[model samples]
Target chain A: MKLKRTIRQVFAIAKTDFLGIVRNKTAIFFTLLFPLFFLIIIGFTFGTQGTGETSRIQVGTVNLDGNMIDVNGTVSQNSTIGDVFVQVLKDANFTVYEYDVYGDKDTNGTAAYDISRGEIKIAVVLPANFTETLSYQYTDSLGIPIPTRAHLDLYTDPSDPTGSIIGQQSLLGFISGFIKYYQEIAINQLPENLQDYAEVLADPITVSTSEADVSGRQLRWIDYMVPGTLGLVLLWSGLNHASVAIATERTKGTFQRMVIAPVSSITVLAGKFISSLAIVYISAVIMLASGLLLFQVNLYWNVPAIILAIFLGALSAIGIGLIISSIAKNEEAANSIAVLISVPLQFFIGAFFPLDIMPEPAQIFGEALPFTKLVYAMQDIMTKNLPFEAVMPEIIYLTISGLILFVVGIIAYRLSLKRL
Target chain B: MNLNDIEIDAVTKRFEDTVAVDNVSMKVAKGELFGLLGPNGAGKSTLTKMLCGMVNPTSGTIKVGGYNIRDNAMKVKELLGVVPQDIVLYDYMNARENLAFFGKLYGLSGGKLRDRIEELLKFTQLDEKAVKRHISTYSGGMKRRVNIAAALLHEPQVMLLDEPNAGLDPGNRLALWEIIQTLHKEGKTIVLTTHMMDEAEELSDQVAIMDKGKIIALGSPRQLIKKVKMENTITVVPNKITPKLMEAVKKISGVKRSYRAYDEEEKIETIKIITERAEDILPEVVSGISSVGSKILSVQLSRGTLEDVFILLTGRSLREEEQL
Candidate 1:
């Protein structure tokens, strides 16, 4: 009879609380819209990689080189080898803007100014002797022709970190290819016996690259971020919402009414947990749906595993919220403290960035956070397409930690009941 | 045999350094409409909460329906219906929804819960349209009625109403008084706490006047007035009340006490002459004041009431205590 009554009371409380949240505009905004806002913003910002869509990087080029002879000693009327190199950059997915270099003026400075103004991500300067040196040849004592080396300078914008790295890499790769093309032409002009030695000397140690098969499909930045975004949604729905629940009730005088009822405090808390768990799942669904529909994120659905992970993650998040609610004197204080804890917690738990790139101590701290484990478990199941067994350790950690924190939360709630 | 429905023995509640409910003992008989009368913060609400098992007494025992609150708190709670001072219902939910939610918490369900909710909605005189509207949109009186209705879903034997008529206009207070009287007529024991002296005198079968965490006087309103031997008051509002006029009134035969009292609400001063029979002393008092060169504007004779009883017992007006 007691167990039946407890179940009935819990459901009653959950039903009322859920209805209250549905009707409350502020609650609806935080639970559904806030996290969706983050997902959409982050998704559009970094979701172009695996979708076969590429945005061109803008680069400023300063060509001081005069029209000089090519390797065949023929001069072009309108363009030099520096123009050919600029054409190579355009072909390699760069929007190149050419900066004119007058007699001894600083043309590199002009390129740098465009970079600072956000018009370009990188600046490239070609020396006046660029084509002359590449075409210059001399006979050694043994009467063998030797080529002179050419130099190029690149200045990258520090503000756009990712763009700077991509610009630098692409420019370097193009220059290497250009040098190899000229080397092949030079080698072909040599005698047959010496040509093989020249070919070997010019390109000694060729390197080839291929992407590793992680999940049978290429993963984009959106795919990696979807799970982290889900964790963030849970943090707000479970932690922030739960933190203010009891304080709001106290302020509204409902807490005293509940206490006066012939119901245990733990039973009331269980009802609150059930309502918050429902909210967590609703928020998670909205996040996943937005990711799949808006960004076309390629992730394994893994419904049962995802449900289990969210349930456990909500336990930890709500548990921490209960602790905060117990400590705060009122609803406003509870809300302020929850935001103070949750904002920094998102970064620390790798909800927005990868923890592996952080320092050792920070990585350890992230590893210890329950939300981080949820993010990792989600990444494994969604990105890696791993089975349940692959994430069993994370599941076990979440379950144990969630249970421990929930127990502590119950104790704190009971203490708060006494104060009330 | 315990004849009382509620018994509080040497109950005290302290918070840190302050004592909210000092060591006190009282018994409320079965089916009695008991009033806890005091100004704000006189520990009436604290004592009511202790009886409801919402607050634990620092010492002693409270028994409701023969169940000790310390050992059988749930049993005590099961027998009591609590209507808190603040409006405790979810403002976003309609009246029926709020009632149904609380009904389920009391272990009522299915047809029984539905029937109880319907009965309460009808009993509170909330129409279908009113029942469908959210509590936040309801008037203060309507919300107070629903607040009381939520506590009645379980049909508890004892009802605790902490200032149920507080902040209500005279019409609403009369309506609530009718509800309380109806409940009392059904033989349900009730403990009502309020700072309003007239509410206590009008509704209580017995009244306990508490002050500084202690019960200063306890009995029926008439019994208390008689026990205190309070004198009838003859109020004379003259064109002007002077110290010499008040002294002359005090020297009149049959006059026991005379003092000039200011009416805060009326913004006027009057001289009150306390005597055994106000009718016999009224003419003499009026003449005494007029002989002292004071022109009589009005003269009235009235019997001592609960406020007079409170003033006689504590030498402080109930209204004065409210200001403090």
Candidate 2:
């Protein structure tokens, strides 16, 4: 009879608190509205990676080389190494703006002006010795002197770091392609006897690469960010709402009345936890539905595991909120403290960036936080489609931390009642 | 054996360095309306909190309905309804919803819970407006009534109200007193704390006056008055001050204390005489002033009130302790 009464009282309090929160229109609106903003903002910003106008990069080039004289002693327009270099960059889909070798000052000045004005990202300058060095690679047979290496100067705007990086990559690709073309042509111009040595120099080390996905379908950035935004919605909605609700009750003396009532302390805490858990689930559903309809994010993978992850995540978040409520003196302090804990973890926990790419100590700190594991567990369930056994470590750790915080929170709540 | 009697033994509660309740001991009988009278910081609320098991005494024990508040706190809570000094009801919930929520906590449910909520709404006279309005929209008197109904939902034998009438106007105080009287007639033990002296005199079968965390005086109102040798005073404002009139008024029967003072601010000369019965002695006081060829401008007679008893015991009025 006693146990049955406790359950009834717990549910009674839970029902009242749940109705209080859901009926609060401001709470209902912000819970869905704020995360939808994250979905549209973070999703579209990082989501569309290789589509439309965003993927194009502009490059500028200036060749000072006059012309190339073939071993037949003819000026071959196609045989000039500078001409082959520009053709290779053009083949890779770079819009190359070519400048004259010995023209008036206006020719090279305009290219430099475009680079500085951020009109172009990369500037390639080939000197007069561009083909003269290549013509000497065939001269060892004649005992004539040959230049050892050719220098290709690359320039980019110092202030435009992102453009500078892309332009530098295009310049490097052009250099790599010109080396192969010069080697093949030089060996072909030589007799058949030295061609094997030229082939060995041109293709010194053979490297191969391969990439495959587990589902055979490429996951978009929206797939990864949706789960993170869901975790974020859970953290903010559960922690802030629960802490403020408990603190408001304390200030209003309603919490004292409940503490002094015939119900047990666990009943009061359980009621708060259950209500926050329901609100979190509602918040998660809204975020997920918005992802599906608005961004075409997939939700067909591991539905049960997603639900479980959300439940455990809400459990841990609300447990922390209970601790905040127990220690805080008022609603404002509780809100400030909850936000202080949740905002920093959002960045460090691989929600916005990968944790492995960060420094080692920062990675360790991110791993130590319970939110990091929750985000990982969410990714495993929602994005990776991992099974229960695969994600058990995170679930177990979250459950243990949640239980500890919940036990401590109940004790603290009871102690606060005595003071009140 | 009175089932609803509450026994508190040597209870002391300390919050860090400050002692809130200091070794207080009291026993209230069953079916008695006991009033705890004290100034604001006199430990009355803390002592009642200990009895309700909301606060733990630093030293000593309390028992209600034959159950120890320390070990059987839940059982004790089941036997008492507590109306805290603060309005502890949920303002976001309507009167009916608030009462229903608290009622379910005490193990009432289904049709029984619904019926009890309706009965309490009507009993507290809140049925008419509670249907569509939240408690936040209710007036102070209406909220107090609902607060009482929420406590009485379980119908415990003992009801503890910590100054239920503290903030109410005169009409609301009278209306709430009528409810207390109705509950007392139903044989429920009721204990309340208040600074209002007349409330103790009008509503209490027994009263305990507390000061500085200790009970300075405890007894029925009449018994306390008789023990303190209570006196009433009669004051007369004469046109001029004279020694003969002061000497004559001091000789009145049962006149114990007298003094004469000239007010410079009001430019009035006044004579006051304290006696056992001011009603009997007032005629002589006025006649004595008239015989001196001094016309009495105004004459006033005051009875022995609880404030008089408090001043005689503590040497301070209730207002002084509250200010301190």
> Against the true structure, whose lDDT is highest?
1
Residue A373 shift from truth in candidate 1, angstroms: 1.0
Using DockQ, give the best candidate's number. Answer: 1
User: For residues B34-109, what per-residue lDDT tens digits would candidate 1 score against the true structure?
Assistant: 9999888789988998999888999989999989999999998899999988889999999999999888888998
Deviating ranges (above 4 Å) for candidate 2 = A29-36, A50-53, A56-207, B127-130, B233-299
Two-chain DockQ for model 2: 0.54
Interface RMSD of the predictions, in order shown? 0.8, 1.3
DockQ of each: 0.77, 0.54
Error of 1 at B24 (Å): 1.3
In model 2 chain B, where is the ten-residue run with the lowest total lDDT? B257-266
lDDT of 2 by residue, A151-196 (tens): 7777777888855875676567557767776777778987899888
lDDT of 2 by residue, B77-195 (tens): 98999998779887778888899889988988889999888888888776575655988888989999989998999989899989999788889999999999999999999997899
TM-score of each: 0.91, 0.79
Give me the candidate number with maximum TM-score: 1
Candidate 2 residue pairs in clash (backbone atoms < 3 Å): none
The 0-to-1 C-alpha lDDT of every candidate, in the order given, reads 0.85, 0.78
